[model samples]
Target: MEYVTLGKTGLKISRMGFGGIPIQRIDADGTKKLMKMLVEKGLNYIDTARGYTVSESFIGEGIEGMRDRFVLATKSMSRTKEAMAKDIDISLENLRTDYIDLYQVHNPNMEQLLTVIGEGGALEALKEAKEAGKIGHIGITVHSLEVFEKALEMDWVETIMFPYNIVERQGEELIHKCSEKNIGFIDMKPLAGGAIEDGRLALRFVCANPDVTVVIPGMYDVSEIEKNMEAVEDVSELTAEELEAMEKVRKQLGTNFCRRCNYCQPCTVGINISGCFLFQGYLDRYGLEDWAKDRYGAMAVKAGACVECGACETRCPYNLPIRQMLKKCAEEFGA
Candidate 1:
């Protein structure tokens, strides 16, 4: 229940904000229930994105009458002024609020970032929206270290969202820079996309970082919310046992594992890149051979279907050799 002012924006939000991606798996009513519980527990920050497939709408429906109780934030992938302007309106309507506390430019690579800040770019629309009182602050979400570094220098950026977990500490230095620059540093993928089995350990590792203004772990149910809240609210220093557990997690996950951000999608051949990696990890690392095989079998497009177009690798923030990895998966699964 600890609260902090989001850098630059001065938005006072709970250290543990609600990530809205998982709500896509549930209905609007389910989201509404979670929203009610969030209010009761005093967890008031909610992060969603227009690309998260119904996430914004569900949140809008969930927070219907209780809009003022939350600091709402969302992002869009639109790189153009027209598209961003349109997305801002859509987000406002979907979130059931005319004024969004924060609107962000979704993950854009170096080229797209330049285009977005250039003439007729999304930044124009975001600034216009701020002037129009549609949004309170502007920010950017990035995956690669290059973009993270570049975003740090942008005067328009009030906040930055990046993946920071026990295994994904590559942004540690830049995250510190965020605090130095007075730009809110929002931590995403605090659980390393569910790679770290211990939720409490994952949360503790993130909450311990003073540079992180907020950590949004996607929640869909009451038990998860309560459990995550307990982990976040415990401000005590990390116990020796917890530190040992975190190291163990880093060792097991290594640096090559997937975080399942789903930035690599629409596989030229329609392969579920992240899903394939998920099942493969379970098959290879967790000894869930049968379960993994079953899930891999169910996929409409298997890893063997990858034609090596390399389109996905270009989008991957980690620059994962997805095609080669898929080849390994295909060999292991015998697809």
Candidate 2:
């Protein structure tokens, strides 16, 4: 229920924003019901991406009548001006809104970022969209620390979204700089993309950082919304017990566990990279050997299938050695 101005953008939004990724798992009607709950609970900030498969459209359906009550934000991966313009229109049509509150450049790398700011780049289209009243503010979502750092220097960036969780505090210093520069810092993967099992503790850890303008946890279920609300609404300071719990989470998860963002898709050989890692973690860490093996068997492409093209490693935001990890899984699973 606590509200804060999204720095530089001047938009007042709830600290806990609704992440639109999980909506892809549910139908429009389900999303509509969840949207009603979001409005009733006063979580007025929404985040979605064009790449999130039907998420934007479902949100549009869900927020049809309650558009005025929310500050809607969405992103696209288009790098060219023409592509960005087209994506903007598509986003509008899908969101069922004429004016988007914020439009972001989605996870561009060094070369792409340079290209985007260059002639006939996506930034040109984003600027045009703002001028045309199609969007209110311009922001960016980055997985690379380099991109995040570079984005801070760009005058066009009003907000920056990055993964910040109990296990991944690598951006802690840069995040503080965001507050100093008056740029809104939107926290993505506050739960480390499901690596951190304790949702309440994860949410609490994120909300404790005053620099984070908002934290968007993907929600498809109303029950999740209620539990997240409880975590975000608690205004008290982090107790010693809570801090200890966070440390325990870090030690347990380590840095190598997959966050399941699925950026490493189209695995060159059809390997289910994230799924393989997920099942492997369950088997290795949790000792759920039978269940994990059952699920691993269900995957059409197992870890042994990895040709070690190293494509997934480049795409991984966390710099995970996926090929090697898969090799371990192959040795363990005997696939």
Candidate 3:
């Protein structure tokens, strides 16, 4: 595996880091297996979050004895000083470590970001933790371009995590600024929340960018790690065929496809908004009809159950046409 220094933090990490989200789908034992593979392969950067159910715990168990082998990073949604401090302790306990390599304020909007930096805010806790040696550095994860641009200007931000893939290039300019300013830029959702079917192509597309410090595509299995590792290590420009494939991907998904941020929650009818769109994508784009139908069937509240109250759209950061999209899903699945 190839490695690079995470900007400003001076921690050398693999070009392809481990994203802890998918560990929720696998057991601790499975995570241990992945940890073993990662250690053997020399991928040292691990990212987890307090919000992801059981992810931190599974990773804790996975890296039990070999904790020093990886640079552990995690984030929380807490906005206040008290909550952020408390969450740091909880994350430390969950990760079974006394110190965390990086602690990030996860995905705060512009308003929430202010609350984080205000008096009695999460930034206070982050700074205190760094001074106390509880965390090595501070960073942030963001979904909005506004927050990304703002984070670039903050001296406290050591790293920034944002979505970058074949379909989402909105942060391309800010990503360059991250490099210019010496803030490590971590790429999330390299597959655009699994919307892009060709994982090899997706991984290649993200790794080709010189500015991306590390790209974390959530991997649950060993074969995926090997494939992604190869894609990142190749260090070659996009072949003409790959360029054409990317163009087709851009045309197919367009700009409006859900990135699966799940900001649009509490679907008045309890519909799993992103889940419906995911299954719909499988059914429509991937030709996995029976498989997609089975997953869609498992959803307790189908897209047809949408009340069209326009509540979800208001919360969507991307401002997706979720109501209309759900209507199409309803028609597609006969829900």
Candidate 4:
């Protein structure tokens, strides 16, 4: 695997970092085996978040005796100082680590950003914890390109995690800004949450960007991991023809790409909004129809949960009519 210094943090990370979300679905033993395999293959940067249920715990359990062998990065969404301290402690216990290599604010919305970084907030708490050696670096993960550029202007942010894929190039300008500022750019949703079926092509597209320091793709199976490793090994510069082909695919996919931006969230009826959009895309883009159907069937609220509330639409960065989309989803996939 190719290694690059993660900008100002000075930590060298594998170009293909292991995103820890998918592992939450696997059994403990399965996760352990996959973790071992990934480590053996030279993938040392593992990224997880408290929001990804059981993901941090699984990584901790999987890497029991090999804790020092890799760099561990995890995030918390807590905005208050007290909650931030508690979440950090909880994360440390879950990850079986005394200190984290990188700790991030997990996709804070604009309001939360102001509150957290404002006087006597979570950002101050994080800074204090860093001084205490709890985390090696302070980073932020955001979904909006605007927030990303704003983050680049901050002195405290050393790394950024955001969505960047072949289809959604909205983050392109922000990626260039990060590179120019010497901030590490971590590409999340590099495959557009499996909306792009040809994993090799999607992975290659992101890696082709020289500004990207690491690309984290969530893999659930060993075959997926092996394929990703192979793709990284044989990584080639994107040819003009290939770029045009991908652009064609992007046009065909259109607004079908789920950046997992979480812009349309907190449904009035309490639906896990992003999950619904993601599983639907799985059926449409990756042909995982049965899997998508099963997952949709399992939602407690399902798509019908959207109460025609205008809240999500107002909040959506893409201006997606979330209520109407949810209605469509319910008609097509709700149990």
Candidate 2 has its poorest 10 consecutive residues by lDDT at 278-287
lDDT of 3 by residue, 1-335 (tens): 88899999999999999999989889989999999999999999999999998999999998999999999999999999999999999999999999999999999999999999999999999999999999999999998999999999999999999999999999999999999999999999999988898999999999889999999999999999999898888888899999999999999899989877687997888999999999998998889999999999999999999989999998997889999999999999999
RMSD of 1: 1.2
Minimal lDDT window, size 10, model 4: 256-265
The number of clashing residue pairs in each candidate reads 0, 0, 0, 0
Q: Which regions in candidate 3 have their CA more than 4 angstroms from the true location?
A: none
lDDT of 2 by residue, 1-335 (tens): 99999999999999999999999899999999999998899999999999999999999988997899999999999999999999999999999999999999999999999999999999999999999999999999998889999999999999999999999999999999999999999999999988777899999999999999999999889999999999999979999999999999888888898989898887999998989988988897778999999999999989999898899898887789999999999999999
lDDT of each: 0.94, 0.94, 0.94, 0.85
Q: Give each model a TM-score.
A: 0.97, 0.98, 0.97, 0.88
For model 1, how does the per-residue alpha-carbon lDDT over 1-335 read when each residue is reduced to its tens digit?
A: 99999999999999999999999899989998999999999999999999999999999998988999999999999999999999999999988899999999999999999999999999999999999999999999998899999999999999999999999998999999999999999999999888887899899999999999999999999999999999998989999999998888888888887788788887898898899989988998789999999999999999998889899988888888888999999999999
Q: Model 3: how far is 189 from its true place, Å?
A: 0.6
TM-score of candidate 4 on Cα atoms, chains taken together: 0.88
| lDDT accuracy of residue 41 in candidate 1 | 97
Q: Pick the candidate with the highest TM-score.
A: 2
